[model samples]
Target: MSDISDFLNHLPADRARTAFDLVHYMLGKALKSEDADEVLTEMAERIGRAGVPLDRATSIVPLLHAEAVASARFWERGSGARSYLFPYTPESGDGYAHSPAAVVHETGEWVRLWLPETPDDTYGIVPELKEAGYTDYLMAPVFMKSGMAGTFSFATRAPNGFSDEDLAFLRLVFPALAGAQDILATTRAMQEVMRMYVGAEPQRRILSGDVHRGEVMRIRSAILFADMRRFTELTVDMSAEEATQLLNAYYDCIVPPIEEAGGEVLKFIGDGILAIFRAEGAGNVACFKAIQAAQEGLDRVAHRNGSPSFDVGIALHLGEVAYGNVGSGLRLDYTVIGRDVNLAARVAGLCGTLGEPLLVSDTFRGRIADAGKKTSGGPVSVWSVGVHALKGLHTPLEVFAVAVP
Candidate 1:
């Protein structure tokens, strides 16, 4: 026998039998030239009677992930996130055998072999399965930029059990498994984005020429509204080209601070921006982040103008808002709505009336204090516009302001 064949031949009766069973199982399930050739005459007859085409990767990958997950349950069911356990790395100075080579190989690859017990038998592709309380294991990688993704891993409880032949067979199977998984993930994400921009799902089914829309999700957040104090009048004096250049310069100065403050610029209305803060953890974090972000915006524009020419009014408020697809499906605007949103706009509007460049709603201000932030001032208000009703709102809101802080 050849070296590879000889290695296979040495397997014990049971292992050898299982190995053959595995080969046959894969051959029958996964279409291949070799398998089809063996039953050519039978295949022809079967095809003549009834034909079945294989489904594409999109349908198949979910099934494969499910199968791997089911198999992992044989070892231990109900483990939170990770169903399959890997070879445990020993603590320093512990009795468990620590092999750097094995550790490096497992960490670097798209596939890994977990032998939980064998501390020393880590050199081979299949780690010492018996010592690690693992009989057979198959691992597939999930490439996600953040946290964990789909991991298809299975394990058995047997000794020196999963041999070279079994390992080689799995290696061949893994590529197809990984590819199908990747295709499904990419397709699902793209489909979600497509659904967002195309409006109705039916519209997306028909159009293939347009840009795939980005998915937007609603979340409770702090809203920041900033506008040029005198943009409408200031631009009238400048030439069209000069106005455009100035606007672009202003955007450059303002955008970075919002981003640095963990805000997404939801819209650029003429010479203003509406940004949402969704990066804060909880509590009044969102409001505090908006305050810091507004400060950053002021500093950036101040530096850019040298003589502080570009005057910007910033306002912040906290409330739940309808924060998803805003524009036509063809051109999306991911923005926010509701009382907090209106309040932010009103606060921005007040920058002119109050003669202060920064203003934050009492709700936003209260949240900042509730989050343990120390600030000096209370109800230093010029207007108590008794619950002035906004255009879209049902109830008039009780609005107050601290023009400067």
Candidate 2:
């Protein structure tokens, strides 16, 4: 035992191998003395795979199995018994039999309890514990941000069960497990934040025409173009920082509804946002969502800046066009490129030309009407381009506008 102690006392000869050996020994140790060691092992493996620190990971489990094993090899003259880690509960004997410990739900907090020994306690013991000739248990709880994540329980076959030293060690290890839970929570939160922006890259490349996807596959979709009205003039009077801050605030107001409606914002060129609603896949639901998103965006922007009003012009077009990843392999963007796309943009630009807040192409109006929906928001009208020939189009298109409601 002293020799083993001496070997571990010095710096590890091989870091990776030492870490591996440490974990293996710990698992074996957990298995030997504890009847419920397998559960702890599963937890340890999960934490390890997540790249959590061993100390932090251990803090979350029944016991830091690895640490227990090392301590056993050093302090206990004889070795090879595993440690059992579980939360303490009243039904099981304080000595060691924590019955029904396997399925007990826990809050993410450490709790200590003394189990009262009784013949009636038989029902609570995990069936496997009885099969393994075990009869007593002790345990502790590990907490997480959401709630009690799990428990660590220890069991023994001895009638007299665990001692003061056993309970003390487990209590000492509880803090470590809690730390690991916090680390995992923070890691997950950061990952979720990253996922939001990272997924948009592929679509960005497709829209930018940096990457090609075997020629553009034309499909019917709802095209949306929104631009901040008089943005150039508005920003010219403000400082760069103020301008940037206002733009960001405006984006914050606009983005929520778009994302909520399952629309993808492809690009933000200057003060305009080009969004696409993949209508074919989600059907009318997608179209409605896009419209809802636009409405929400308008409302949010209006509320964000009150009194001295800031207005946005939006145009929607429903049409078939070449849409997909179109560009060199170096870069690509998932976007639509065709007469319909152009028409939508032209309509958006026309919002400024007509001094209207919202405008929609006849194509968009026709689709919504076919779906049994009425077009609202035009009590206050603007120059309605009744029917005019749009450049590069085979036929004339009708356009209308409404005030910034």
Number of clashes recorded per candidate:
8, 45
Estimate, for each residue in 1-405, the C-alpha lDDT of model 1 and write its tens digit: 334456455554554444445445334543433332223222222212221110101111121121121111122322212123232334421321243322323574533444554344454434444544554455455453322244444454544544454454444334444443454444544554444343332234334433344444345788888988888677777889888888877877777877886776766778878778763555376676677777777777777853327788887778655544455667764444566677778768767765667776656766766554344322233334345555566766555553433
lDDT of 2 by residue, 1-405 (tens): 123333333323343343444345444444343332343454444333323222211222222221221111001112222443344345323433343333343333333322343344554444544555544544455455554344454555555554443333333333444444344434433443333443354444433454546556665778788888878777788989888877777778787688887887766777878787877743454455556677788888777753335788888777664656656766755555788778877778777777766777765654554443433422222346677566667787789653344
Number of the top-ranking candidate, with TM-score as the measure: 2
True-vs-predicted CA distance for residue 14, candidate 2, Å: 19
Off-target runs (Cα >4 Å) in candidate 1 are 1-217, 279-282, 306-308, 326-335, 372-405
Model 1, residue pairs in steric clash: 116-132, 117-131, 117-132, 118-131, 118-132, 135-156, 135-158, 387-397
Task: Report lDDT per candidate.
Answer: 0.52, 0.53
Considering summed lDDT, which 10 consecutive residues are worst modelled in model 1? 51-60
Off by over 4 Å in 2: 1-219, 281-283, 306-308, 321-336, 370-385, 391-394, 402-405
Candidate 1 accuracy as TM-score: 0.42
Candidate 2 Cα deviation (angstroms), residue 117: 35
